[model samples]
Target: MRFYGQQRLFELTTSELERYREKTRELDYCAERPEKRLLAEECREMVTELEQRKNRMLASAIRRRQREEIEHALDEAEIDAEEIIRELEGESA
Candidate 1:
């Protein structure tokens, strides 16, 4: 997968984007070497950008259920990212 911009994420369906973000997060957490971690960090940043775009889309969504779902997904992604960061920090400590 291309890890450059939100444009790729914008092209994906919400579900696909979420899955991609989650997978990227997992890869970030599993990175074993410094170079791998650097690449993972880049991917994580892309996912973060995608999340921001998703939030903007969520704001303009008209459907209540869709908004709620996106909100929930955002919350989950934030929590997951935080946890992974903490885990990585702990490993380095």
Candidate 2:
């Protein structure tokens, strides 16, 4: 379940990435100048940084989902243990 805040963040990140890509393309088109070439390198670095950020966000989401699943499983196991203990007491009584 993606919350509204998360969805908005994802959209913003995508927009920023696209803008960086556009800047890189413009620089590349006129990269005969040394300064333009330098700016293009920086633009490329920003694109790489954005890609890494996306990967990190995906990893975080995966970890969060796995943690929730583990907690749910532990809760079910605890309930089952309690039920078994009650049955054992009834038999001994």
Candidate 3:
């Protein structure tokens, strides 16, 4: 797909871009050594798994940050007594 903007660019999501970079790096590494095909495959699989885990962890971190910001804002606002009490209770518990 064509990514329309100021510069000509290939359309790729963040994950796709990461994977593409990883695949290219792996290809370059594998090309240097011709005899270790099995090891190369295993390493490539490990890299893929690691990248997937990294993405998942990053997403979780972003969500946690957003939740913290929302909680902070709620704490800052002066709401009804019931709401304030609920917030205090939630905090203590």
lDDT (10s digit) by residue, model 1, range 1-93:
224344455557466667767777777777887876877777777777767777775555446567788999999999999999999999999
Q: By TM-score, how accurate is candidate 3?
A: 0.48
Which segments of model 2 are wrong by more than 4 Å?
A: 1-3
Question: Which regions of candidate 1 fall more than 4 Å away from where they truly are?
Answer: 1-16, 22-26, 63-93
Give the Cα RMSD of candidate 2: 2.0
For each candidate in the order shown, give its overall lDDT on alpha carbons.
0.72, 0.90, 0.61
TM-score for each model: 0.42, 0.81, 0.48
Weakest 10 consecutive residues of candidate 2 by summed lDDT = 1-10
Put down candidate 3 lDDT per residue, 1-93, tens digits, no spaces: 112541122223345556755765676677667655555665567667656765665676678779988998786675666688999999999
Better of 2 and 3 by lDDT: 2
lDDT of 1 at 23: 72
lDDT of 2 by residue, 6-79 (tens): 76777777889899999999999999999999999999999999988877777877888899999999999999
